[model samples]
Target: MAGRGGTQGKSGDEVVERGGERDAGGGGMEGWKRKGKRSPDSSLRHVFPTPSAFPLFLHMAGSEYGRTARDVLVACLALWSVTSLVVIAVWRTSPGVRSMERCKAELHRARGRLEEARAEWGRRREELQDLLRKSAQNQTHLRRQADQLTQSLRNSDASVSRCLQGRLTYSISRYLVF
Candidate 1:
C-alpha cells in the first residue's frame, strides 16, 4: 500500500507496491510485478483524508482557483492602465499645461521679432554710413569751387583798376600838348 509520502509503482489491474518494496520471493523484476491488485477506495484514501480536501490540493493542474487568479491579475493590470491614461489626459488639459504652451509660443514670437529688429538695425546702420560718406565728399567739392571763384574775382578787380589809371594818364598828356 502506498502511503501519503510514497508513489504507487505499476499500471492498473497489476498490484501496485509502495516505495518499490520487494516481495517474499525476492525475485528482481518478477517479484516487483505480480503484486495483488487493490481497490480504488484504498488507493485514494491515503491521498485525501476527506472529500473537501480534494479541491484544496495544488492549483498547478489548471484548477478553478488558477483561472480565477489569472482573471484577477488581468483585471488589475487593465485598471492600472486606465488609471494612467486618465492621469495623462487630465494633465494635458490642465491650466498650467495650457499656460506653458502659451509661454512657449510667445517666446518663439519674441525671438523672431528680435531677429528682425537686428537685421533692420544692420541695414539702417549701413545706409547711415553711406549718407555720411557722401556728405563729406560733397563738402570737400564745394570748398574747392568756392576757393576757385574767389581767386577769379581777385584777378578781375586788379585788371580793371590798372586800365582806368592808364586812360587817365593819356588824357592829361594830350591836354598839356594842346
Candidate 2:
C-alpha cells in the first residue's frame, strides 16, 4: 500500500523514500544492508527509468535488471581497456615516432663528434703556430752565426796576406847582400 508521499506499505512492511534514498523498515543504509537485498527499483535507476525502457529486455525483477547493468558495465570497461592498449601500442610502434627518436639520438651523437673534432682542430692549430714561431727564431739565429763567421774569415785572410808580403821583401834583401 502506498502512503502519503515517500512511505509505502509492502506486505505490512514499511519502506520509506527520502531524497532518492530508500529505508526498508529498519533504520537507513544499515537496515538496508542487514536485509542483504538492494531495492531493485533504485539499483539501476540512473541507467533505466523503468523496466519497460530497457532494450530487448523483458519485465524483470530489480535484481535481474541490476545484473544486466553490471554485465554491461563490465563489458564497457573491458572494451575501453582494449582500445586504450591498442592506442598505446600503435603510438609506441609508429614509424614516425621511432624515426623521430632515432633522428634525435643521431643528432646528439653528431653534435658531440663535431665538438670533439673542433677541439682537435684548435689544438693542432696552436701546435702548428708554436712550431712555426720556433722555426723562425732558429732560422734567424743560424743566419746571424753565419754572418759572424764570414766576417772573421775575411779579417784573417787580410792579416795573413800582409805577413807573407813582409817576409818576401826581407828574404830578397838578404840574397842581394850575399
Query: Which candidate number would show the highest TM-score if scored against the true structure?
Result: 2
TM-score of 2: 0.51
lDDT per residue for candidate 1 within 51-164, as digits (tens), equals 565323322112345548857887999999999999999999999999999999999999999999999999999999999999999999999999998898888878887888
Model 2 spans > 4 angstroms off? 1-84, 168-178
Give all candidates' CA lDDT scores.
0.63, 0.67
Error of 2 at 175 (Å): 5.6
- lDDT for 19 in candidate 1 is 28
* Clashes (N, CA, C under 3 Å) per candidate: 0, 0
For candidate 2, give the lDDT: 0.67
Model 1 global lDDT (CA atoms, 0 to 1): 0.63
